[model samples]
Target: MKKKIVALTAIAVLSVGTAAQAAASSVHTVQSGDTLWSISKDNNVSVEELQAWNELDSTLIYPSQDLKVEDKVETYVVVKGDSLYKIATKHNISVDDLMNWNNISSDLIFPGEEFVLQGTKASTTNKTAQKATAPVSAPASAPVQKAPSAPVAVKAPASSTAGKEMTVTATAYTAYCAGCSGTTATGIDLRANPNQKVIAVDPSVIPLGSRVWVEGYGEAIAGDTGGAIKGNIIDLFMENKQDALNWGRQTVTIKILD
Candidate 1:
């Protein structure tokens, strides 16, 4: 009778221990001293459950072997006013770097769109890239502030009217010319606003006061016109003569905004 009583107590204890192990069982890497049973007990999982998750025929495991932990994923939903600049600013990263990170083509983004803030399962499947590091624009405590003296990022509110969309041969030019008034058609002082993005387009092709997106270049103000700029030809104003020469000529997509 005493033996039977002890047997019942042992069964109850074993049942409780199994439940505890099952509760904590998810996925864990086999550390140096880790065995299949120890891993299952620590994570509150069964050895068979771990085997099933890892598709292992036996309990044999090795260090650094990745096992399924959780199916949870991380993502971000785009809000109404979320621009690349704003989102990147929030994440403390650069606009160009963000574009590269997400493989984003243009600044255009819609609400409710999802982006992977963290890595996916495939990225973690390999032991090499255990965690993906998001680029840090700066330290977390300090807010990212642009220098007032530096040129703007060129992402301005575009005009309402998208008058035309075309492929044009764009050539760069400097403010200093042989016999030129160092001023734009719209009277923007380039000598003063040297870094300000300004482009020269034929008034007939793209009217003055128009905003445009030039491929390979950011947005620019169509505040200038050039004698040579006519029809499909556009003159992109560079800050210096060297810049003009560097961007000799290229066929670029132009989005003509109001």
Candidate 2:
């Protein structure tokens, strides 16, 4: 009877070990300032798996957080002033999914939390991109000279190849508030609000934080605008006060820098 009991205990231990190995294809040791998003990106696992395995609540995962690597894992330590968003971007995982996995109740997180890695899948869009069409403008009060044809020799960034070019396009729009940004080439002065942060932009072609030069408007950063600006265009913030007023109707070519 004694021998039989010992044998049963050994079998139970082995079963548990096998189960653990099956559930986690890889294991990651948390370093200082590790977040779930970072771990997921580093490894090829989804954020949901990270949460389900680690049982996290709140989007916050701290340094020294031990995480299961779904596949190949290279351990990384978290740095200071790291936020979940930055980490998610670094790892390429959705912040929402990261939060859900960790059972994170609040955004609150401190340094030194430990966790596992999750990964993101590539995005595939089903809808075809619509080509931009020229909109009819109100009759000008004064006669205006026709601008020269767009230059054929002008080189464009490789990113813009994703969409067809519009003869005329809406570069930016006014956002009265979140979900309230007005559209159209209404001739709002762009220089009125100077030094504003970028609200939105086309991530594929015109990356955020890129400085651009406009033919008519001088130098400006690709900053602030509506959801419609996504894809191949950019939005520039005007200086405050009369800046928006000074922006009159004009056509210009935009050049992006390296």
Candidate 3:
């Protein structure tokens, strides 16, 4: 009958639609002798990524298990007090990577905006391959001569006044100073992370743990406090005494990014 034919045609269309949806999501079945590292190698992904995508606490797997081999698009929603640097630091990723993943050319990002956390697998694999194939320098038998220090031109990051901006008198200090514990008041270990960008601020003026953009200094975290760092005065952190001395004192503009 015509009615029976119509019902069978509708059922066939629904079955085909379901099959297409399943095929779109790439899933790999775990077989005997399979490991996370081996599966990652076969799929052109990293073992860390495998664990993250599957939300697996460990590398243990059994036969006939299903694993998601496709790259999962992870995203983060910007909050009231969030900056690219802050979010990248929290996620243990670079700010450049974060910006590139989101196709962001500027540092300006608004609250409630969503940003992608990961790039495509091809990009990630290419970066890893480049690192692995990089040429290593041969060890020098003789003492290498030190080059003369040149005046390096530092490029400041793009300016943004998304939050409060203030002109503050800035001074530089090193963590290796005499009698210094190399720890900030906010519990950031400067000695352990000499490259970490941090600045001492008056908690009343710039709240601790705030992401601030300092003029000529780029982005930094307000993670320290000083006895003399009162009012509009801020102390920038440097890795070495020479760098601190070079920075000396300057009047700079600071924007509280978050």
Off by over 4 Å in 3: 1-162
Return the candidate ranking by lDDT, descending: 3, 1, 2
Candidate 1 structure, TM-score to reference = 0.41
Candidate 3 worst ten-residue window by lDDT = 1-10
lDDT of 2 by residue, 160-254 (tens): 33122222233333334234332212212233433432323454555433334455454444333344665555554443435444553344455
| TM-score of every candidate relative to the true structure | 0.41, 0.27, 0.42
Candidate 3 local lDDT, 132-175, one digit each (tens): 22222212231222223222222221123225678999999888
Give the backbone clash total of model 3: 0
Predicted candidate 1 versus true structure: per-residue lDDT over 1-258, tens digit per residue: 000101000001111122211333344555554455445433433445556778889656676676654232233334334566777666665765545434455555554343433322112111111123232232343243322221112122223334346899999877776665666654455777689788888768776555567887766766677668888888888888998899999998877643
Q: Which prediction has the highest lDDT against the true structure?
A: 3
Could you tell me how far off, in angstroms, the CA of residue 17 lies in candidate 3 after the best superposition? 34
